[model samples]
Target: MRIHILGICGTFMGGVALIARELGHHVTGSDLNIYPPMSDALAASGIPVRLGYEPKNIDPKTDLVIIGNGIARHNPCVDYVLNQGMDYISGSQWMCENVLRHQHVLAVSGTHGKTTTTALLTWILETAGLTPGYLIGGVPKDFKETSRLGAGKYFVIEADEYDTAFFDKRSKFLHYRPRTLIMNNIEYDHADIFPDIEAIKKQFQYLLRCVPSNGSVIFPNSDTNIQDVLSRGCWSTQMATGDESGWYAKLLTPDGGAWECYFKGEKRALIKWHLVGNHNVQNALAAIAAADSIGVAMHDIEKAFATFSNVKRRLEIRGCVNEVTVYDDFAHHPTAIATTIDGLRKKVGEQRIIAIAQLGSNSMRMGAHGDALSFSFQAADQVHVLRPEDKSWDVAAVLKPLGNKAFVHDSVADIIDVVSKAALKHDHVLIMSNKGFDGIHERLLDKLSV
Candidate 1:
């Protein structure tokens, strides 16, 4: 089938494009902003891509339009497709019919850990010699690809609860029709979309509604937010664990670098993943439960986790020079930042942790919860707020409470200068942002390399 993807540059949609292309489908996409690494990845896959989205980009040859969640009804091409009554569905819906309708869909959904968990699931399956097809929001560094259309019978996906698209008001995961749903955690997010935490929980309820009776759920036992939803009643089989519960991770120290965690549970020491932090522990436990259900032995699962490199930009060490290590992470939320910091603190003990974050995500830039930015930076010895004058949010007001931990900076150069002046040798400068922050990591690396 010939597939045209709207908003193809988005991480999720881009993976769809790559996987579709690998499946021998004619894949083409249009996005207003097109650049590496997404553009580079798409072009390298030999997929035809249109520079900008317009109604003219669509025609009779297009069999399906994979509308990305990022593209709204107001988008010219989306608006045109809607007006013409064309055959179009969301990325999630399209995946439901084409990629997962008959396969074992291992769906990982949560306010956190979805990407890491999905990647962990894929890695265990791969290391255990199962070539699983997968679509992840973040590119798994080990595979170097976000989507792989392999011959594996299993399909792994990071099941997000965000609304599918403008046409479909339900969360994207609803259309996924998951056979196994890994409910990690849930909380308030996407302020512009859902009105309250309960409103978002309702979407989760709907996702749970779609799980077939034979399917199961894996969740953190200690999360009160998760408990609130689980109390509502679920007929599907379930597996529960917390950081300190039945299935848990014991952090194992490795060499000078890297983190190893042991996944011990009632039946086995299922897995020991190389990823760090409590969040990753939950990620491994969730993946372990899914793997156990699929017949991957506990010990082999542990070996897979022992060597599993994390997804790219998720606590990825970009460079180290003059004893200062720079890391790039895709953590934009407060909880995510805190967890990432905790992980780094353990790995690079006693080093001053310098964190630089950008208010770049739609949720961050929307200004609805600007104050939360302060809480996100509490772990950094010194914090740099990129694009604080983002025009959408009151940056100064948000940083006011943080006092010394936060500082508003316009460019990457400014951040480098502050770090050089204040941070001592062996310090860890961590850069966190979902969107590429003006290629800030490389620029910082170049400055640090000198």
Candidate 2:
């Protein structure tokens, strides 16, 4: 079958296209914004990607149109499909009918850490020789491609709570009937779609309802929001992290490079890795619990964790030059920003941690987090925020509590200058954004080189 995808450059939809191509389907896609590295990956896979949405991009031989959530109903291509009466389905729905239905799906979902946990779990399975199929939101450093169809029975998915498509209001994870579900932690996010935290929790309830009774659900006991979602009613076997009841972890060192796992208070395995932060420790715990449901031995899990390569853009060290380290991270949300900064702070310890953040995500741009965002950056010695011109919220007003510690600018160049000046020889610069912050990481390095 021939499939043409709309909004194919996004991580999720791009992964779908790769999987479709791997399954022997002729796949082509169109997106308004097409650039590397997704563009490079798709082109390397022999899949043709059109530059933008146009009625003419739809091939006469196309069997189906798989639309991504990024497309709206009024889009020209969508209107063309509707006017032509062509069959169209969402990315998640297409996967449900074609790929996920055939695999033992293991889904990792949360407001944060989904990509890393999914990558870690997939690597663990791969290291154990499971050769599991996977569709992660970002490219794992260990894999050549972001999505693949392996010979193993298990399929790992970085399940999202976001709505499936413009036509479907259901969360994308609902289409993936997971045998092992990891609820890393939940916080109010996607303020554009969800009106409140409870609305997001309700969606989680619906996802939990889909799990079979014999399947297992793992979450952090430290997250009260997750506990509230589970309290609504849970039928599947439950595992908890940060508590001794089901599965938990203990850090062997204050630096967070090594950790020990426990299952119901019994020592399981000691894992040592380069990944930093307590959040990553919790992510590892969730992945371990999910792996256990698939009957993977603790020793194998430990081995995989020791060598696991995290997904790109999650605290990825872009470069280190002249005793200064620059990191690229996808930390648009308040909690994610806090966690990423905290991890870096722990690693460097009193060494200056300079942060370059942008109001990229819709929630952050609208100032949905308000003063909460200011507190998230307390660990940093100084923060430079890229405040876009169109935002109605007063970025500086909200960050006023930080006083001289915070600097807000409407220009990317200004933020880069501030970051470069504030950063010293031993400092660590964390560049945080969900979208590309005007390629600030490399640009900062160039400016600092002078």
lDDT of each: 0.80, 0.90
TM-score for each candidate, following the candidate numbering: 0.92, 0.98
Error of 1 at 339 (Å): 0.7
Q: Which regions of candidate 1 fall more than 4 Å away from where they truly are?
A: 83-85, 243-245, 252-267, 270-273, 370-372, 389-393
TM-score of 1: 0.92
Clashes of each: 2, 0
> Over the stretch 347-378, how does candidate 2's per-residue lDDT look in tens digits?
98999988889878878877788869899998
* RMSD (Å) of each candidate, 1 decimal: 2.7, 1.0
The collision pairs in model 1 are 271-302, 273-305
Worst 10 residues of 2 by lDDT: 386-395
The prediction achieving the highest lDDT against the true structure is 2
